[model samples]
Target chain A: MASTLHDTPERNIPVQRISTTTPMSGVTSHPGLAAWSLGYREWLRFVRQRNRVIGAIGQPVIFWVFLSAGLQESFTAAGTSDVQFLEYFFPGTMMLIVLFTAIFTTISVIEDRREGFMQSVLVAPIPRFSLVAGKLAGGASLAMAQAVVFLALGLIWGMPFPALGLLAGMAFLLICAVALTGLGFILAWRMDSVQGFHAVMSVFLIPMWLLSGAFFPASNPWLAWVMAVNPMTYLMAGFRWLLYLGSEERIAAGTPGLAVSLLVSFAFCAVMFWASCRIAQARVRGDVRS
Target chain B: MRPSPAIVISNISFAYSARQALANLSLDVASGEIFALLGPNGSGKSTLFRLLATLIPLQQGEIDILSISVRTHAVEVRKRLGVVFQSPSVDAKLRVWENIRHQGWLYGLSGRELTTRGQELLAQLGLADRAHDSVETLSGGLRRRLELAKGMLHCPSILLMDEPSTGLDPAARYDFWTYLRQLRDEHGVTVLLTTHLLEEADHADRVAILSEGQIVACGAPEELRKEVGQESIVVHPIPDHAKQLAAGIAQRLNVQTRTIEDEIHVTADDATATIASLLEQFGPMVSELRLGKPTLEDVFVARTGHRFWNRPADGDSLDAKGRANRKGVRNG
Candidate 1:
């Protein structure tokens, strides 16, 4: 009934007040720090979960060895005269590694929500865009790290690894990692559970990878049209061009040109990144599904 | 001049799909006060907490925290608010210090300054020795303390907590309250918390009891209790005749009576006199009777005309006197 009763002096005890003002340094005020901190947290979680790290990398390696070995004997394509299935599937497996790492890293978004950490972050002073960027960066880093390990295996497998080619291929992988992880982040952001995310990945990510010129060349007109629209197709083509720089015979004939592939991959990365930022901003307007 | 109130909520309402959680609710909390939003489950206390903490968007009405609008100036409001959610927010994989440090970073505290503050909070929460341990290794009580440490890492001027003592043991709850009081006393931090527990509400300096998205009673706990009555007299008639006995007592004594299951509850200023008169009038019908001081639970019952813990049965009539009591309390 009393509106101002809580303000009475008798009810308020006299204790030394600690000053509430925080020292404002430019570094602390920068939104980048929030992003960096979030990214660091994600990295710590990833490395500490040994099983996750192993599963993310090992599954792709097993898929590469088994799928290529099983298909090498009977696999034949119109453009390739003497190409081995192992060589043909090498770039696909690299993409697979990136995709696996991306999925593993972005899955934490759902876990964070369940654990209540996302709620705390949502209420903080940091911008929502920074949160998105931080998450993407964290996931992209892990994806790229695993992709590099597989790239090393490509080198050992005698897929012509020129120094410039390796550098270009790493750069391409980085771009692809950012793009794929951003896509995964968008999917995971709207998903409430890991099973839901997996279902979405199966419906969306797997088909995109399959349609990319990963296993067989898109020699047929219909399949080539589908592959032309797939972003991962450019990624696979660009990676193949970079990995076998001097050996044009080893590269698939129908794969897009290096410049065209780079341009498309960059465009895809930019669009995915921008779309993710928009989704994060939309969440501020309370468009959250959960 | 006195400082502005820490929080001002006006005409706020929220709904999840078609089910309304809060409706046209308004309240104020002064700076450096321990204010409790008391209610049973589904009373909209948690909804109000989420709105104040800026965890959820304001769908209708306005809320201001520390002079910043929660709708138009959410980031600024967030800067002044430290929230501990009802669910555990600490990352189980991260060490105690890492969690605190990460929270500090989100509030724009970094470098050596953030580290110092993190250590200070850990030490203050009695978690200095466990700073290096992973959060999963800590017990529930310790984890709760760690959550508090993370919330306070940024030195927020106002702390919003939802069911803060939900999973704590009795001793941990005591320690939690002590820390809340210390924050108010030593640092002048205002605290607003939601609790379904009556004892927790009793410990607050002021409480607002919500029922079905409305504030049924709001004032100092003692004042609210006194407003209802100083004492309550409960009588148990034969199970089948409980409703009849309650109606007869209300008509004869001109006192409000509510029947919850087989028990007839009446609020009286003089319990001994009421009991003596009741025994003389209806001794054969009365099976058991007891007199006790009014509690927060009693206040809720008086204002709502139903048990706080149980939903009123379908098709039950609300007593007119109880409606008047609620109207009178709300009007003042």
Candidate 2:
């Protein structure tokens, strides 16, 4: 490798370098700015890595298309009157996109830790809140962006949805994305390898999504109890209610109220975010191996 | 009065699960000086670097930077520190300018001021032309220059680098050290770097030689080398009679001799006279003879009673343990 310090033509140019005494005057630890930079970096990386875009949005769309098409005749969103599988599964597919995006974005946590980028951030003079908030914001925003694309696709597919209802549904989806991203952050924070996160995704994240009544209605008493305890169920209920608000079939089916669903989703998001912050602040055994 | 030391590490110790990495280590580095922690693999230099960088929490004792306690004022210390890690910390996907911009943001720098500072640093490091290029497109030496540019981007008063010359060619290494010297001399920035290479450590103002988690010797490289002797004579006898030749030479010369691995080392007051006597007395027994001014390696051997690179039982395992610890850090 050639010397970068002395070989260039610019080396002959006499320039006075800034000394440490001045220190880029007025620069200090700004948590908000640091957080914004971190979040923006995630967006930059996402745009550059085309495979990540496809994996997060494309794979989930494929699943939704094939699964809904195959089950359109046999499955009829049991217990809901006159609800077609395509529309009934619309909210679920949107949720799946958010979940996939969460997985893709959060997996970078493990990579950053391994590749030494996290070491730089860990040593920076910023509060742990900035780190956690920045990462969750990035993941949540990416997930929401993908979910919105799916939402647009659903509307174009001719599902009956009012403008006001669709706007409210986007709000609900943003909250859902935040909650799911927080979950991913918590799981990926301590994980050392992407494979370990994948293992966790299959055993924990996928099952959580499956049991949230996104793929099928929880008509069986046992299944209903499971979905009732799952936090994702509230997110799905809140989103589905908003997307189908005032529609004859939705009103007849009678999903959970907006207030109750929002309350539970907000509570879940707070807890997950709080837990991730605690992990980030931990001074022992997490930042480095020993 | 002289300013207080820029870094004060007092009686610090760290250990892995069952193996100790650093024990009761203490040293102080003066401001505007280049201090090197010189050691081979598993000598605890890297562990010390990590603790100082705040990448790992201190296990025991205290480390204060510019009078601020690392335990309580880590963030404040971080503000004063610019660290270049052994591993490449810059994102390869990001353009060179993008990496610098983001680094500035992490330190609360932004907008016009950051752009100007970044540009100035890029020009100084001879990377201005490649500012818009992706980092992955650069060679190892250029990437290292970028790392240096990032470390200095915040205009930190102190710079901490771990194995800064690990992957560089000889010319690049020379350029790197020349720039570091300029930082210390022109900007009055204190530098603390860890290196296993003796030549690299020789460039520091002072070097602390660590062995088995302790500082066996600490001083200027020349002073430490002088402590060994005025000159060093390495006698490599035939393999079959290495032990006998060492004993015979010790008796014949009536001087202290150390037998390390297959060679016998004799620190002599006069190399010319000693070599003549050894050749006359044991010409057929000796296979090779080398005489030179004492080096840091000679100092290390004299202090530790072992070869610098070859270790006893504990050292062999230490290499594996150090590797495993690195893997653990990466895997985690």
The top-ranked prediction according to DockQ is 2
lDDT of 1 by residue, A1-290 (tens): 22121222332212222234443122224478889989999889998899998998898889889998899898764566877788788788888888888888888888888767888888888888789889989988888888888888878877656788778878888899999989998888767789999998899998999888887888789999999999899988998888767766777678888999999999999998888888766543222222
Q: Over 4 Å off in model 1, which ranges? A: A1-29, A75-82, A283-290, B1-3, B251-254, B311-332
lDDT of all the models against the reference? 0.80, 0.82
TM-score for all models, in order of appearance: 0.90, 0.92
lDDT measured at residue A40 in model 1 versus the true structure, 0 to 100: 92
Per-chain TM-score (chain B), model 1: 0.90
List per-model TM-scores for chain B: 0.90, 0.92
- Highest-scoring model, TM-score: 2
| lDDT at residue A268 of model 1 (Cα atoms) | 92
- Candidate 1 docking classification: acceptable
Candidate 1 global TM-score? 0.90
